[model samples]
Target: MEQILDLETDRENQTAGPSGRMHLGGNDLTVDAGRVVLDGTVVGYLYENGFLRSAREQTEDDEDPDTGQWRLVDDLEGCDFQGTTQDGLPLSLPGPSSPGPTGSLSYNGRDYQVMQGRISNAQHKILGEYYGGGRFVLRDARTNTERRSLDEGSVINFSFAGTASDGRDLSEQYTRPLYRDQISYHENEIIRYFQDFDRLDQQQRDYVIESMRIWAASGILQIVRKKEGNAALGNVKHGAAGVTRVRTGMVDLDAEEFERDIDLCARFGPLAVITTRVPSYVEVRVNLVVSHEFGHQLQFCLSQAAQDRIDELYQARLARSIAKFPPPSAYDGGSELVHADQVMHREFISGYAKASVFEYWAESVAAFSFKESRKLLRQLDPGIFSILEQVVFTPEKVMSAVLCEQILNLQASLRFGGEFGKNLLD
Candidate 1:
């Protein structure tokens, strides 16, 4: 037999029991007007067809509670709430929730993994205090171990055994060896030596080390310095001119040289070389040039299929730029062309990106290293962002957690105090 209940009339005429509480399915529900009150607090409201819209949970510290945390119970039967807590932790009702009264919690820029409602640090050393009712007691300072661990593997191991492709060991040529005994992590060794490496100050050297760590850790053949180069700050190339020689099987050379080159087609990586007496600029430009050259290194190291995808994306972006702003006839000089390129490719990170597909990619990589440019890159071309995230930023590719952390920290730092990429093209 089918029984139909008149929900509208029932709700309008619904009244509380003598004690101001109504009994519904063994639960005491207080019906005050159209609201369902639980223990003198309004939990939800009765709607048409006897449906109850559950009220959203509120945080004690939220200024706008209504917009902060909300859960929607779409159906009266077999419905659950799914939303985030006030602390931005994921919240799901009914069973097996996150932070489960004894789990990790990230609050106010610190991580706490608690057991039995007690908070602990990374080394699992308990602070001997319980975090009751969502209250946290943060440590005054991080331990030295914790601080050092942040950049543990950021320094690459370099072996000065084999001679550079230039037929001489640049390390011996330079009087002052800047990074002779600075081995940090136990990853694969790359043959690297700098010429005139001591010219830069400590801060400049630190920036160079941090910026180049990701590429060096990802199997780049070498990091060599050349005393003479064509006015360029840095460049990446295949075998014979840079740090390590890579056998691409395209050119036939002597068996001895071929034996030395690594044979993995995907791993036939390029060598990165900077001028011997490279001038130090602002930190932003220093990081940008190194990372940009490594961007070319990354292109050579990638598989053919991955390279094809990048080419496809570049062509698509180029078409969009051409469509947006057609090229003008006559230009005064390079400045006019640069200005026109900036307006034409407003979606790109910089005007230099309009040079060519390779330049576009290199410029994108350089910009993606900084905080402000990364945000703008995501906004402008999420395709490039997704591609870079998959290929360059993964732990499997980078192979060092410390190097990954260094890249993250470099990305977090703002260039020019957030006025970055405003009028600058480089």
Candidate 2:
């Protein structure tokens, strides 16, 4: 029981009478002037002159009628075509040569022939297609579908070569090559990760930056993650002098003296900002510390207040402890010498001088800039106020009268304009 479907056989010359001929499954079929053979089974026995026909189910009109066409349920309800072969096979339909369905594709340096027609239905494409050529149809190996085209060279390379149900020698050409794009998906994933990072709003970014500052001050500074570690970083320094130094440790400072400590150490441009590790943490507090350090730098950059303050503190210690320091330079500016009854001698002496006279003046400026900052810390934690009070005012001292007035004037001008003194303090 071998069923053979031959191409080039005429329909009138064919004979089907269930005698001395191989029994093809589902009735004897033919194709393109060739004898058709469905080498499967024949169960349902309904015959006219021992030649039989089986009805096929019908499908929706939108489907490919050739593939979608089906017989009525009643037509095949009791039909049991005998099983001629366990393997599914197709046979040629008796008629003039007609294309089964044709498509051409090239892969792996070889051309292929696809027998299944291009899928016109969207669903079929989603599920994929099959391959066909010669006398039979086979599954498309490239996309793993029934409606796929195969190039002979590609098919052999992909390992697909055999006879289809139609008894036609299939050329490996019907199978498409498995082509994969490696870079596209990888690039997409990278972009997606960056987008996820970007999706974080401003508040989240700020929180992260704040945490970094805390860790840095707490002596935990190190490269947690360097995006471009080997790239040259511009030269910058954190010392009082312009010298490069890499930091690797933390320092403990009285949370009270955070601003004071940072101010004493910071210098403008090329100087590192000062910060200290504290046990209790708050993003706002760390932000205040950074503001204070930069405040020192801004003051130094703008005026001579820093040098002046340093001189004053030094002279105070000299007068009390050693008593041989030279007297401060004479008040050289044309400003009037105005002294208050409660002002310290140092204040009177310094205030009578011009605005541009001393180095400590920069410290005064930084202190002025940090007033609101100090208040913010106090609002967050009141204990920080005592630290501020100790540095600026005490039982044995008063700030230089001129420095104090300058600070007050700077505040007034900023808050209420240059004509601020015209109004009473509210």
Whole-structure CA lDDT of model 2: 0.26
Q: RMSD of candidate 2 to the true fold?
A: 31.1
Instruction: Write down the TM-score of every candidate.
Output: 0.35, 0.17
CA lDDT of every candidate: 0.37, 0.26
Instruction: Identify the candidate with maximal lDDT.
Output: 1
| Residue-by-residue lDDT tens digits, candidate 1, 270-350 | 211112222321011112554554455455545556667777887886776567544444332111122422432354555
lDDT of 2 at 200: 40
Query: What is the TM-score (0 to 1) of candidate 2?
Result: 0.17
lDDT of 2 by residue, 306-412 (tens): 33544455355334321322222453332223223222222212221122223122222222233333343344323223322322222012232333333332222
Count clashing residue pairs in model 1. Answer: 0
Minimum summed lDDT over a 10-residue window in model 2 is located at: 224-233
